[model samples]
Target: MSVRAAELPSRDALQQLVRAKAGTAKVHHLVPVHPALAPLLPDGGLRPGAAYSVTGGALLLTLLAEPSAAGSWCGVVGVPELGAEAARSAGVALDRIALVPQPGERWLSVVAALAEVLPVVAVRPAGRVRDADAARLAARLRERSCVLLVCGDWPRVEARLAVDEARWEGLGEGHGYLSGRDVVVSVATRSTATPRHVRLVLPDATGRLSAKAPGTGPVELRAVG
Candidate 1:
């Protein structure tokens, strides 16, 4: 029995269905991250339509590689210190990256606009965000299914990822130039239960991130409710 084309659902109908089911994991689209860092994330990837507060400027920006590589648009606002070279080195598609070097007082507005279209938006607030503004941005992210990657302090975030005790692997006794860095990355969440940590190279000796061999490096895991 062949079904008529008219019986098929319209694009708008499909979109509405996705939005209605967005809150559930089944409907939500997850973007993959570096395998080494996957163990730290709740579902081992980036969940769209949620906000994540992360520490470490470079490490925070590096999270976009997965989505960017998957042909998604990424926007970086109010983070002048993050260089394009670093983002590229971390496997981000430079052409797909939209950068607003200094968003100043309009950082929130810029993020809101980008979230409407981009799949991922990373921001480093120049100053404190009012509760009202935060709420509005959060709502926008939910509606548009955009991932908000924050690089600084944000109140009432869905999850918080921080890199701690980072130790450089090279340049001991002022002999060699900078090489790689090992850090303890901890991820904790409030919206969903994700309590785990991992020790990995932010960038190994060859400038690529990978998990440290077990028993060869220190490990620390924090228990959370």
Candidate 2:
């Protein structure tokens, strides 16, 4: 008996299943991640065929900003709340950043499609991403020399960038508007035996990422009556 098309499964579902059954392959060549994050990575950047999980929602914009400014096309899927102003402020070239905020039930298909054209694609999985699907995406990424930045959890990731601690520098006991923040970044990779880490200000008072360690000196925050 023949099964109905709806029962057969969609293209995304098949890809995920196929990936789960596929074997791993080696990928060479790395793309420059954000300048601040580069030093923390063993390869100093993202590998074409690997997946990465990162904490800090704001970090998504900052991380993509790097390659985007360098003329690489970038896309964001599944993060509807991400704002254009924030992305622009973070150094992402507005013209090169593609935003798909919502893709409904076709999130995976959308990601797959973007991966084909964009060199960098940042996606926050709307739901649990099966290992099979993740693997398929990774394999595709490697083939296309693309960087897949996953905002949420994914199976068998190459590395994970997590924020251990974050404290604002401009907050006062009674006054001052929010200014800069100091954050500690922890890095872990499945391929490496050990992990790397760093501490820096994502956006200091000047509204720019500090290339070096964060400033320690305390400063007064403006008070308004």
Candidate 3:
């Protein structure tokens, strides 16, 4: 199935459907992440019922890949530029993912409704979020044991991940095409005073994430306009 913007469901309808489908299955405390990204997380995986602030679309896709592959439902809200091909290439199971490209004034409601059934939901707020609204959502997430990945700022988050540096490879003398990106990702948790950094091939030549090998020699990089 393709990942495309879907029509929003009514809150009552969505809740009833979720209740019917959810049954009484228990949710795991953590969701699996890419092996390369395990070390960066405080729990070695994404903790259920918690919020994480993430920067970069690639990184968000990376986070969803493992969970979706494991048969978990995922959703993305308010990201109109989310490329379906890129998501597929990044290993996301498009059949199990929902895309809400534009939530407009109902962004929060859409996210909340999705959280009822989706184990993992990502959203880029369309406007500034009020602290009270965030707090209410946080409570709902905890109650449902759902994981929320916010692309933009949140009033509170279990952890924050940001790409500190990035460089593309596979170009030589302006001849070869861009193939992969190497990035320095910084992970910060509320419990830690300083953030931890990890270098990774965000998307290697094969379009999958991997830890950057140690002691790799640096090559001259040309700035791209």
Candidate 4:
């Protein structure tokens, strides 16, 4: 197996990659994962050419939903486990998100093609994407200024965001639709700074984003015992 990316770059180089851009201008009414998260990010929204890795395919799809819901074209490459219903619930315009049934060794080429036309491109991590390939991808990403969210470990990628596993609760004796599991998904991780942790209540049946417990204080995760 190849070495982990954390092993290749020196501490200084990693730090340089993770540092937020200086002299950021303020944008009015920006949408981020949450209120607290908005200030932590320089763009005030999901940054283009950056990668956000989730624990599994479900979360990966969820992360891609927002951009798709906003009428952006999303290209999903090498993902076979995606469900139609879940994709809809996540707010991805099913019509707009193209699913490549099979993307074999042509991962980089596919990514290159999608990055030019699609606004948000999601690739399921499978094989090795070398530092050189990643460099080319990053260059193209910069040129296109499109958002690229990958679903696995990428050492060559300059920035990354890792969402922590969520805690669930508040189910009473087989109540509600799910398996009595009230999962509280975490919105945590920073690409160019220290990691941040926040709580986001899952959207309702109508695909609305809201908090389970309403309050003015810091949001906390609540789950069943």
Candidate 5:
């Protein structure tokens, strides 16, 4: 589904429409993330109605892939550069995904609207966002039981995932093309004083995220401040 900025509805209207479509049921369970990433999250997955800040677009798509494959509707806002082919290759269900590439100044409203009905919503802020705006949206997310994935920074978030180090594989002696990337993913949450780090092939040879094999090499761990 495509949402044009000109046709975007008010938060109230969107909430009503969502209620009509999905009723008042609240999802209290955690949404599934890729197995390779589960260890980084305190809940072992994404908690419903919570917001998370992610550093990379590939990582954001990876977060959505598992939930989308589990039959959840996912939405992307203000990310015109998101490639559908890449999303699909990352294991996201294209058929069940909605794209709002340009929400303009109303990106927050667009996100809040999508969060009401979509189980997973990913967005890249078009500009600086106020803490008040983020707080309001947080309330909406809680009410709707939606999981928000912010590509950029947010005033408040349950957790933050970042790629501290990355190395592309499949380029040997400058003869082969790049096939995959080994990244050190770091997760910081309010509950932990220190961020947890894990190494994985963000997009393995098959274009899927997977844990790096044991004894592959030493993984460098760094603190994220």
Candidate 6:
């Protein structure tokens, strides 16, 4: 049998009901986009069944591979500009990732349908993502235990993670093979509590993003213009 969470007395009660109904569970470790975001999340990870907004859709899609590195199903919709090389840099295993080619109003429908099978679904909230649609999507995600990562400006999501341009001070690379060396990027996010932010040196290796350095101070990142 199934029960609506709205009817539960409280969140704790709902959790208990879910736990009892859903038998044993296995722990899945979460890889935070940055160390600064670790504490913001209850278990140093993205909470399942909620929405996380990435400031830049491209960057967000790349970073998403971190948590789902264990062969989990990931879906991206309404984004056709994704590059294979960029996907590699963001640590996504392109071979396993599904890129659904949907445009216009069909994107939202694709997102809703794909969420049933994909563990983590990322999308650009540009076309067809209305407030009512977001509400329905959130409910479906919660019911299905699918994590929805929205990459754009959407006000109805459960949480928001915004990224800004990286700050580099006194860092230089000579005109050689080291031209792309030592670049840093910073991202800031707002939650129910205080705002959280962090900066990290871009990963030297392709197809991966390093976890934030522990106890590192956050550099202020204003929105990208």
The per-prediction CA RMSD against the true structure, in angstroms, equals: 10.0, 11.2, 14.2, 10.6, 13.7, 9.0
What is the Cα-based lDDT of residue 101 in candidate 1? Answer: 92
> Residues 1-225, candidate 6, lDDT per residue (tens digit)?
999977769988779888766533412534344453465454466656767766654447545666556677788887788776767666677877888756576787788898887778888865545788888988887667777787676656655665455433333343223212232233334544655554544443343444445222334456997
User: In model 5, what lDDT does residue 146 have?
Assistant: 91
lDDT of 1 by residue, 33-66 (tens): 7777776776667777778888886676578887
For model 3, what is the alpha-carbon lDDT of residue 196?
95
Q: What range of 10 consecutive residues in model 6 has the weakest lDDT sum?
A: 175-184
Better of 2 and 5 by lDDT: 5
TM-score of model 5 (CA atoms): 0.81
Model 1 lDDT, full chain set = 0.79
Best by lDDT: 3
Which of 1 and 3 is ahead in TM-score?
3
Q: State candidate 6's TM-score.
A: 0.68
Residue 80 in model 2: lDDT: 86
Candidate 1: which pairs clash? Answer: none
Instruction: Please provide, for model 3 over 1-225, each residue's C-alpha lDDT reduced to its tens digit, 9 standing for 90 to 100.
Output: 765546667788889889766634433358999887788887788887889999998899999999999999999999999988878888999999999998999999999999988999999999899999999999889778889999998999999999888888777685777678879989999988899998888887767788866333336677999
Query: Candidate 3: where is the Cα deviation over 4 Å?
Result: 1-28, 212-225
- What TM-score would every model get versus the actual structure? 0.80, 0.80, 0.82, 0.67, 0.81, 0.68
lDDT of 4 by residue, 71-177 (tens): 77788888877777877865677899888758888888998899998867788766977888888888787667667777787755433544455433333454523
Count of residue pairs whose backbone atoms collide, per candidate: 0, 0, 0, 5, 0, 2
Error of 6 at 60 (Å): 1.5
Q: After aligning candidate 4 to the native by TM-score, how far in Å is the CA of 158 from where it should be?
A: 5.8
- In model 6, the runs with Cα more than 4 Å from the true position are 1-37, 168-191, 203-207, 211-225
Clashes of 2: 0
